[model samples]
Target: MDKIQNQVRPVFPFTAIVGQEEMKLALILNVIDPKIGGVMIMGDRGTGKSTTIRAIADLLPEIEVVADDLFNSHISDYDLMSDFVKNQLENNANLTTSLIKVPMVDLPLGATEDRLCGTIDIEKALNEGVKSFDPGLLAKANRGILYVDEVNLLDDHLVDILLDSAASGWNTVEREGISIRHPSRFVLVGSGNPEEGELRPQLLDRFGMHAEIRTVRDASLRVQIVEQRTKFDQDPNSCIKEFCEQQNLLKQTIINAQSLLKSITIDYSLKVKISQICGILNVDGLRGDIVTNRAAKAFAAYQNKKEVDVDDVKEVITLCLRHRLRKDPLDTIDSGTKVSQVVDDILS
Candidate 1:
């Protein structure tokens, strides 16, 4: 019974996911360049938000991490290593390394600050005279992905904490004057159903991109999606087998994009136009411009391009800038449409 309970269930393949291209693209872009911040997805319920996010774990290539490290610290990159691991390296201590799947941490709505940010073991610290820290979701998510579902319903305080850590690329925990800081760099993906509620604009703008999806309007496409899901439910292994090729191909594309992202440059003129759109929209800060630039480059890298083009910018501009616009309750036009209009006007 214990063995059965421990068996891992099969995950639905990312390649098998139907439609939701914008959402998929946003996720891929974030994977290619995590520094693009993370993606915020808002749409109707049952649109495969959670499934799509979970599938990303299957798609990501394995990474080399310090063996036995709680933070999944990178073997060589100091930026990706925890303070504990860095200290060992500085001391010239022998370190073992292991390759593990890129972690995908699901942040539950009911989780407390201690659970998300980790806690210092006060009893152990006082008795042992050494800092004993227990890592949390943020630590486990280092060099990986952190997903928050129904983010709008989450407590605003928690959301703020997450945003602060994500932006700073580190999580700090302090208890009884003992503080522990570690690398918490991870792609922060969030999804929510808009009908339930909306995230505050200030909080929402922190996300690098926003993908708004809707229920499939096409009857045939809906039927196809239903059939695919039914097939997977009936025979999970076989369904996974069917899309194995596409999944491998996508994984390779993502890996290639990650390596190529640094070299993929956007033109100076394109940069000016992107900022112009932000300026016209009255975007609060330079985040819009920075995200748009990074997202465009990431998109180009995903397409295996050497340089960014107008088409690449066009493909991602809406996703990058849509959530940054201020809400106009009096205006009936949606934010996506407003961004599109500006893109067309400026790019035309």
Candidate 2:
């Protein structure tokens, strides 16, 4: 039998995207520090939530991964596959490393539970009388990004599966006398129109940050967006060529930011401020505090700063903890308004 060919898919350019700076920043922060967990973008439809995520493919730094691994396992000290792969390597075993662009797999709304979790290859097993594990989206998304559109409308079962995988950084499956476990760590990026439905609280809590985006109301910006999009649709090759230089520069900036992220430090004062903000907001768990601190650090790193400052903390607090705040019956305060109030109180 002939081997099947895999085709490369095109992704939108990050530099070409028009607006929604907050969403772009949140996604960039997560990439700089995956320990920030993930980001959720909830807003009106057609506001470029999905486009912004797809654009991420252009900005990611290339990663060195173990060749032929189901999870695109990283060859690093902190890698989840370090134990297994290291043992194999120490036994005079040979391992190949491949330079691959980071993955950004989309989980469609209609995806089945099994498809998301992976399942047995019954056909392959029956014909060959051998057990074969058919990898799923989660497996392919390892060490990359997993984007879900209309996430609020995804089935409850799928949401549960995602939460479990996101929490453990691994996906485990058992059935038909087969048990399999694989590293499934991926930065989760979920976008949805909040008006359509509410995301389950369990799933919502898994997100490290949340950004709300709306359509560009500025007439000039809107016009420019439309014109640029029309031009790209009409002549994709030339249109992309026109922006390729800028996009490449932006990609390098991301690579530089990632390199700097490791050296960025968080100040004790800023840590207290982050804690105070979360405490004032009455956020329920320690996750909020951890994410806010990490995001602030990443934001500073992105700005090429060596230390986190109050401004960086203020800028990322809303994205990190807005969705985790306690609501007051009489306040009727939106997350944005509440965040602003907190910043004002802190800065004052």
Please, what are the lDDT tens digits per residue for candidate 2 over residues 242-325? Answer: 878987887777777788988889978778877887788888888888988889888898888999887888789889887887
Q: What's the lDDT of the predicted structure labeled candidate 2?
A: 0.81
Least lDDT summed over 10 consecutive residues: which range in candidate 2?
1-10
Q: What does the lDDT read for residue 284 in candidate 1?
A: 93
Clashing pairs in 2: none
Which residue ranges in model 1 land beyond 4 Å of their true spot? Answer: 1-7
lDDT of 1 by residue, 1-348 (tens): 323521457789999999999999999999999999999999998899999988987688888899999999987898888888988999999999988878889999999999999999999999999999889999999888999999999999999989988999999999999999999999999999998999999999999999998999999999999999999999887998899999999999998998998898888999999999999998999999999999999999999999999999999999999898888889899988998898999998
Candidate 1 Cα deviation (angstroms), residue 294 = 0.1
- Each prediction's TM-score versus the true structure: 0.97, 0.89
What's the TM for model 2?
A: 0.89
Q: Report residue 36 deviation for candidate 2 (angstroms).
A: 0.9
